[model samples]
Target: MVRLFILLAAVQLVLFVLALISCLSAARVRNAPRLVWVLVILLIPLLGPLAYFLWGRPLPAPEEGTVPRRRRAPSAPDDDPDFLRSVDTEQSRREREALAQWEKELENGEPDKPQGSA
Candidate 1:
């Protein structure tokens, strides 16, 4: 008889703690305010927690009139035509000039050392 009483007390404590935690942490609980739900849980013990779990949980509502967006990987800079076209015109001219200088040096017997590298 004593063992049975201790088991029931443990069950009641578990129910009360679980109910309080669930009530406090829920995104939005049911009709009653959070303060009221908390009071209900504390005052009523086992029944308070059970009632909150059954009726106070938020139900996910589908958003109306919205089209689902398709998830796609972002395009790389090389894959984007707009990004490729956006390269600086001055930079392109500089690259062309450098290439011409390198080719001219290769043809000449005496060549100048490259400027950027020591």
Candidate 2:
């Protein structure tokens, strides 16, 4: 019976320390504030630590659940509106002309050969 009591006490002490460290280190917590959580862990024995574990722990940051920015956003120049907007109009017109010429070459079924070199 003495051994059992000693084991329980040890468990309670471990719980109290874990709860206190978690409460202090967390960037934010839910329900009660940090001081209240600290007090609860220190004063309420086993139940205090259990309550802090259940209610005072912070929710996962919202960004953690979603795809990262690189995966979620467009990676290609032609597909991204912002990239197109930042391009100079003259440069954009030149690109369009180059694309049109390439398409015309494809339609003609001619083997692509370097011009001005042949």
Candidate 3:
């Protein structure tokens, strides 16, 4: 009976050590508070491990060969007003330059000059 008790105690001790180590390791990987993890492992020894197993593992990244589905890029109208304004200003500048060149050519009557009549 004493031998059986000793064996059971040894098994419990090993499990507790494993749980503590795993909790510490997982907490380190997860960037969680070490003191909180230590307390959890010590206080709710069995449930702590179960909780970590269910929630601690990082979600898998998308596979290397898989093509991500096409999605529209998010526009930050309010958050990035300056960026939108810059784009708008650039487009306006191009339009103005094009119009100016066209008006200058028209004023010079270049298009009205007979084409292919050298």
Candidate 4:
């Protein structure tokens, strides 16, 4: 039917325009050169755009002046400054607790037991 033909033509036109715009606006193309993509889109309508969408468009590259993210290196507790400080504080607290326990024992006239005995 004439209406069917018109609809098909309109679809083709829309596809061609979308492909052209995408090809032009893309920062980088993959699998083929830009010129080749342009020619393909112009000469072969549907398949060209399909191919482009599937494989020709490259993943977006990091913008200029932006550093690519990197994973931090795993560090030991001793190697990390923050971890070392936390460990130091914990050790001091334990020492204070032990000292307080010993002072209490002395006040009660209880002799200190050997550490290994407990």
Which candidate's TM-score is highest? 2
Pairs of residues clashing in candidate 4: none
In model 3, which range of ten residues has the least summed lDDT? Answer: 50-59
The better-scoring model by lDDT among 1 and 2 is: 2
Candidate 4, residues 1-118: lDDT per residue as tens digits? Answer: 9999999889888888888899999987988899999899888878888788788877777899998777665476667877888889999999999999999999999898888885
Instruction: List TM-score per model, in order.
Output: 0.48, 0.52, 0.34, 0.48
Q: Give the alpha carbon lDDT tens digit for every residue of 4-110 in model 3.
A: 98997776667668767776655253435666666766787566655544554334567899976566555766557677889899999999999998899999888
Off by over 4 Å in 2: 62-118
Between 1 and 4, whose lDDT is larger? 4
Task: Indicate which candidate wins on lDDT.
Answer: 2
Candidate 4 weakest ten by summed lDDT: 69-78
> Model 2, clash count?
0
Stretches of model 1 off by over 4 angstroms after superposition:
60-118
- Candidate 2: 10-residue stretch with minimal lDDT: 64-73
Candidate 2: C-alpha RMSD after superposition: 9.9
Q: lDDT, candidate 2, residue 32?
A: 85
What's the lDDT for residue 30 in model 1? 89
- Give the residue spans of candidate 4 off by over 4 A: 60-118
Better of 1 and 2 by TM-score: 2
lDDT of 3: 0.68
Model 1 misses residue 68 by how many Å?
15
